[model samples]
Target: MSASNNTADREAKLQRNPHGDFNAVEKSRPEFEEDVEFHYTRTKDIEWVPGSGATSDDWKKHKKIAVDPYAEGRDPLNNYKLLIAGIVPRPIGFVSTESKAGIRNLAPFSYTTFVHHDPPIFCIGFASSVAAAKDTLANIMETGELTINIISEWFVEAANYTATNAPPEISEWDVSGLTPLASEKVKPPHVGESAFSVEAKLVTHHEWISKVTGKANGTLVIVEGVNFHIREDATNESFTTLDPKILKPISRLGGITYGRTTQAFEMLRPSWADEEKREEVKKILEK
Candidate 1:
C-alpha cells in the first residue's frame, strides 16, 4: 500500500480502539530488525553509486506542490499550522525582562534570530496579541533592557515552563525555580542555569501589519548585545567558538516536537583560493 493509504489505515484503527496508550497500535506491527548501532544514525565515508547508463537530466523530478496562503477557501489555523510545521528546527530565545516597576518577566520565543554578529545584534519577535502594555515586550519597552539566555538540555524543562501566559504582576521565574544571575550592564537578569547569556538593550522594533486585513500581527524587536557571558568549559581554545557537544541545545520542531543536535555533518564551500577546487567545480558546470 502507499504511504498515505497506510497512514489512513492507522487512523482508522486508532478510531476503532481509542483506549490505552499509542503503543497498543504499534504492538500489532513487527519490530524493526535493522543492524543499527548506538540507537541513532551516524555519518560514514561515502561511495557514490556506480552506474553506466544515460543519466536523466530531470534528476528525480518531484511534483511541485503550490500553496496560496491567502486563498479564499483556506483556514487561518491551517496556515499557521503548516508554516510552523514546515519551518524545521527553529532556535528558541529564552528572554528575560524587567518592567520599570521592577516586575520580572521570562518567556521563550521560537521566532528569534541573530541579525548580525558584529556589534552583536539579535531579534526576538512577539505576536501582536501581546502588544497591549504587558508581558515581555511591554517590560522591555518600559525598561529598555533585556537578557537572552541559551537553553541547554539540563534546564529545558524549566525554560519551557517560563512561556506560560501569566499575569503582568506574576513572574514566571517564581514557578520555574530558575536562579537569576545579575547582568553586568542590563537591568534584567540572565538564567543562572544557562551556560551562555547575552545582556542586551533595545535598539528598535518594527510592527508587521497584514496586507489583507490591515491588522497588525506581530512586532520584531531588535536589540544590541552589550555583554556576552560564556561559560569557560563550553568554549574552544580561543574561547570564541562554543562546543556543540557540551551545549546540547534543543530546538523547536513542529507542534509539541523538539529536535536534538546529536548528529551533524559539515561540508566546505568550493573556494576560488584553491585552483584545483575551482577547476573541479568548473568541469561539473561544463557538463
Candidate 2:
C-alpha cells in the first residue's frame, strides 16, 4: 500500500477506537466490566468529617444530626420552628364553631380538605393539642354543626392569625378583628370577610393515633355541607363561571411557600368527528 493510504487507514482506525491501549480502555469503562470489584462508600464518608467535635456521648450532643425528643438542653421551640418553617404553604381551612355558652369561635387548620362530594363531605384534621380543638371538636360533637369559611388570598393573613394559640374563652374572630356573619343552616357563624363559606353538620368524629407519641392526638371531623354562601356577583349560571382572578384562592405548598391559582387551562376529549380521525390514523399506523 502507498504510504499516504497507510497513514489514512491508521487515522481511521484511531478515530474508530480513541483509546489506543486496551488497559486504558478497561480503566475508562469500569462500569461495563462485570468482573471488577465495586467498593461502595457511605455518604457520611464523603459529606461528614469524624473527629472529637463530631462524636457526642449524650443524645443532646447529636441534636445536629438526628431529632432526639428526650434530648436535654435542647429548646422545644427549635423543633416547632423547624416544623412550621419547613411545612411551608400549608392549605388553610378556616373552621367556625359555636360554644355551649353561645360564644362563637373561628379557627384555621392546615390539615383540611374535601374527601367526598357525593354526600358533600369535607374534613378538618384538628390538633387536640390546641385548646381550640377541644372546644371546636367538642362543640361539633355536641351540637353536630360547624361552618368552613373558604379563604382567598385577600383573607389568608387574617386566616393565619386565627391559627394562633388562643384560649378557649377568647374568640378568634375578636382576636383577629374579623367580622362574623350568621349562617343560614348551621350554628357556627362564617367569617364575613371570606368570599365563600359552607354551613355543614358534623357526620363523624374519627380520632387518630400519633405516630411519634403513640397517643390519640387529633380528631378528623367529617362534615356534610348543608348550604353554601357564595359572593353575590361571583357565581354564574354555569359552574365554570367563577373567575379565578377574582377568587385568588391560596393553596398550601412545601415549606413556607404558598400557591395561588392564577392561571387556568382546559383540555377537550375526542368528539364523534375526532373519533373518526383517530380511526383513520390507527389504520395508517397498522399498515
Q: Over the stretch 1-287, how does candidate 1's per-residue lDDT look in tens digits?
A: 43334435544543433345757866887864333222234334332222323345465576768999888877555666677678988888899999888989998888887889888999988755334434788887777899998888778889888866567788999999999989989999999988889999999888888656686657788999999888888897776888787777878887666666665766446455574455455676577
In angstroms, what RMSD does candidate 2 have relative to the true structure? 26.6
What is candidate 1's CA lDDT for residue 235? 94
**Whose TM-score is greatest here?**
1
CA lDDT for candidate 2: 0.68
Supply the global lDDT for candidate 1.
Answer: 0.76
The estimated TM-scores of all candidates read 0.78, 0.61
Q: lDDT values of the candidates?
A: 0.76, 0.68
Candidate 2 regions with alpha-carbon error over 4 angstroms: 1-91, 129-133, 211-213, 238-241, 269-287
Range of the 10 consecutive residues with the lowest summed lDDT in candidate 2: 43-52
Model 1 lowest lDDT segment of ten:
45-54
